[model samples]
Target: MTTPSQDRPTPQDRPTPQDRLTPDELRTLFLFEALSPEQLDWLAERGRVERREAGEVVYREGEPATCFFILLSGALSLNRVLHGDDVEVTRTDQRGVYSGATRAYLGDRVEQLYPHTLRAVSDAEFFVLPADEFAYAVRTWFPMALHLLEGLFFGTRAANAIVNERERLLALASLSAGLTHELNNPAAAALRATAGLRGRVTGMRHKLAMIADGRLDGAGLHRLVALQDDAVQRAATGVSMTAMETADAEDTVSDWLDERGLAGAWDLAPSLVAAGIGVSWLADAARTVGAEHFEAAVRWITYTIDTELMMGEIDDSVERISELVGAARQYSQLDRTPLQIVDVHDLLDATLTMLQARIPDGVRVVREYDRDLPSIPAYGAELNQVWTNLIVNALDAMPDGGTLTLRTWREDDRLMVEIADTGVGIAKDVRPRIFEPFFTTKQVGEGTGLGLDISYRIVVNKHHGDLRVTSRPGDTRFQVCLPIEQTAEATETAESGETTEAGGAAEASEDG
Candidate 1:
């Protein structure tokens, strides 16, 4: 519990003579049901019953675990802390249900700390045993189980660390590859446009010298400059043409250029047509320069339009490259604060941009963003990983081709982002175990089954948010809901189980 409801009772409460359990009474507990009478007697002699009034805490999480507890009466709640806020795991009044020092049998091999905060929802009683005694009893009485438990614990731990790291590397490679491919197209286009622009400018210079070789007066030169400006304006504001319209227009321009004896009529006519310049503009240029200098004027004007189009191409290519870089920066959140108020749309868009190379043309992506949604405090890069995992998962689901829809909006105090896809949905039998660690319906090697598990920790455990999914044959929606009013600390570390340090918030770093 982040805030205690009442003063925590000091750990001075002790059992009276009647508070102890006899061997027969201890047999009633499920844990000791199979133990021998001598073993039960050993526990009965050492264990005692303790009482906690309603609203009093039995144990706070992260404290050195000193006792083993089994509920005897009343209700209790288990709460986990994240960002200094309590997230209730469960509330139960079941007799014989256990809590506190669950892993005491492992002894000093691992840190003996309470994993969750336990509080008395109502007046409660627990049969408590000291950690050392419990550890000794278990080691001596159930040596086989002790060995098995140790193996299970350490083996699962080792397996997770190894598999998770491998998954992270593979995911990193995929992301890097996708980003590299997405970046290359624009970079190559810009390079090509720059090369073409150089030759166009050189040709225009030679045409300028030929035209101004004392044949044309100042008025003709001025008219040529005005016509060049008009061509640029038309290129910018030109209405797009249909394929048929463009073909007919280019044919007509080609015929006009041929009649005027201009070379490269076939090549130059398309450039003119593309700039929305027809024969009438060419004739006006002819009159301004007169027949004596018309050829030079047309060549000069054609080079001018060609360079304008080429320059526009270069601008677009450079702008595209800049946008990709910006998206990469946004997705990576490099050199930025770990936590901040961020627009959900920005993160979603950036993730989409990064995944662009992986998204095939058959699979369309649609965005349905509520621009009015309020910004929420979050770990920006981590949240981008969440979006990345969900979106990539959606893409994977749609193998044959389908729509991937990303929609965001607000509901009450929560901002909701839904990554929905049209694909064969999750099976009914498989749905319940989807959040469990390493549980997957997919074939081995194809999935580590940690994607949803890690995603849940980041959203629910780290951010105190919610992640849910709804599915059908043609549609599956994974929606993440985040609180708009974040009452927790602005900065928080992600150190849940399987995630040991900063910059590594569980789930293949959300790389999945």
Candidate 2:
């Protein structure tokens, strides 16, 4: 735990603040060397020299950034708070290096909090200017330069947001098309089955009328209705049969029907056999209804069984459609809180569902999720985009079909998700540039080259996490590490940035 500020020594605990630099003394630093004599004088009057002991924080992140500090002597490091732990991002001993309220000139348009913590690695000296004064001097000294800088900063951000949106829409369109294809299969099956079911129901009603036309008494008709119920039950729990076994069963039923002089025996035999009805069941039917009523009773029962079987198919197909629709909603995170504690496995499963049509029959997906891993606070829809990009890249990697594996586990205070592909791996020369913006290996018109770059920003910049890759022929993996707990930096990034959806490159090892 950090000691409260009051418990730490103040400047009074050490030597007094050093005298301000003279104009010539300020010009000795590289940063001020380009300044005019008048500009140097202006800085010398405003900037003060401050000393710090090693291991002391100059300013904590998320504090109201109040000053700008330029190195004079000694070494220092920059650290970002991640999951309550200070993780060092950089260290420098170069004179004139600066830190602190670097973006103060942006004014109230953006929050003025320090983006990272600054710490002295050794007893250090820095020239400090109050943040407001620094902002005034920078704007006054170079108004045009400041305007250009502002344009560049905000322009890049705006461009990224626009492109990120385009990327997301493209992905959504592709997935929606795939979903349409997947939904069509079951929907078509249900449509055809419904029509067939209506016909079977009508045929059963006509057959029933024939059986009860006084040729069979109420008691016999009641017996036939009981037989119909049994047939329907059998159809529900139909037996699985091999080709030869099915052929033999159908032949036996057909022979029995033919021997009784029933027409369409061959056609009727298959449906009866499919419902596990055989010669023994036929004997019982004949005994209950007698010779004259046996044929009509058998036809009605067959139609009843067939109709029940068709309804089962329709039920299964409709249920499948419902499941697909549910998975689509889950994948899109529609109706979900943008930021919430979420199960990683659910996100993975939903991505897989959305990509089901795009995944080739030859490419198999294997999930290796550690269910015990704690849920994490995250932007659900954004993470789904990360999954989509990674999985799509994996599919592209294995054009001829291979295993695509998704694995998740807990590593320290972070959760790690790995997407692996068994395909021609990423080239060694290209690996370093994989996450650079607009760096793609795909041919023109095929990729945007921002998939991994956006993924890196979301995972690293936004989540205060890490993304890493390792590759070899037939074995390539991209691992995304996310903090399981919300850190101060995560909160700051959330407050500062727009949440954007991610997309994948069409080529393997994403160039888009």
Candidate 3:
């Protein structure tokens, strides 16, 4: 084989003009196909073929919609740069053409001005048609003009659809962020309580073992029982008390009880009583068991109560977790089809649960639900997404943590759900675009600015409902209004247990 350098074509070795484009070759381009041979030749003389390397910048947006281009080879990526970042707008392959000539020919106001830039991804070739010639061709050829116009319209629509999708993705990102934050709290609390309960239960088992072993007399047993009682009480107090205070009180009682061996004594109570030690004998034994034993008894009681309280806490935590999971399932409507009859409360509750992970530690969530609310036909998952976005956004505004109040009430024929947050209020200027896609006050990468936009679509476009927001410093509320009835099919499905809508479910509330 010849060496690569020797095999490469020299400048003189390249094809001449006659070889590159024959007279017939000029007529083959789709847009120019209708031109007469003489006209095609005239056009070809003015046309310029340009080559761009990979990663080359071809054009900028808002640069006059001048000469149109037909890509003869390679790929082109299109993007809009906003706020110092490149947001990809679209991408086209080799068969694509970048022509805004229809707008120029029609004399319509250009919707997008450009210094918008285009870059080539690989070595590429394009045919640039002069503005005047292209305009003349478009106006003179009805089919060509119509084709160009249709292409332009389709391109515009595609661009719009891409933009809408981006906005939606951004909103989803924000909602997910908020949801992650919401999940952490109850999860952490439950873990801590579970750990505490394990320790308490261990200690309780040891004390019961000692009592079963007959290691203590009736008096010691009585003192130990009393200590167990006191421990339970103290544990209850711990629930309402500061952690440090609770720990200190617990430690003191535990130490005093240990000194008297009251742990062992209380552990022996049942055996002592079984061995014929009476209550009177045990009371007398308490006097002999000493102040240390009494202290130990008190401590043990406190701890027992603490254990119980912790158990209750764990139970409550589990319930909350269940509620959250249920809410999520309902909100996402994962088990159901895309469109279903949904209970508004289920959607709201799921949204709250999802955002539960995000609410600040100091913030409290309150709910006032309307008992008379009814189910509506909707896309449950999408509607849940709407609620999740709004409520989570509200939680984010309150950095120091305030109250998030949710209310549902019936107005006229509509059912309304309102979510209000006590956070730094929305500014007037930004409020206008809050529901616009990809608009955000959050730091870059921290938010996508799509939450409210998607919410608006879900409520207004999909559900045929109303979504409105009212905000002030320390108070921001979002109101969602939806119809109360579903179509006959929805009702029939619901009756058959094939579908479960969230409407008519009891209003539920959560506090953080």
Overall lDDT per candidate, in order of appearance: 0.79, 0.82, 0.61
* Backbone clash tally (model 2): 5
Encode model 3's per-residue lDDT on 156-236: one tens digit a residue. Answer: 456646765675576556556755555566788889999988886777676665557775678678766654554445444
TM-score of each candidate? Answer: 0.84, 0.84, 0.50
Note the residue pairs that clash in candidate 1: none
C-alpha lDDT of candidate 3 relative to the true structure: 0.61
Clashes of each: 0, 5, 40
User: By lDDT, who's the top model here?
Assistant: 2
Candidate 1, residues 123-234, lDDT tens digits: the string is 9989999887777777776778789888877777778777766766776688889989987888888889889889888988898786557777888788878988898888
Order the numbered candidates by TM-score, best leading. 1, 2, 3
Error of 1 at 220 (Å): 1.9
lDDT at position 104, candidate 1: 79
Question: How well does candidate 1 score on lDDT at residue 208?
Answer: 71
Error of 1 at 466 (Å): 1.8
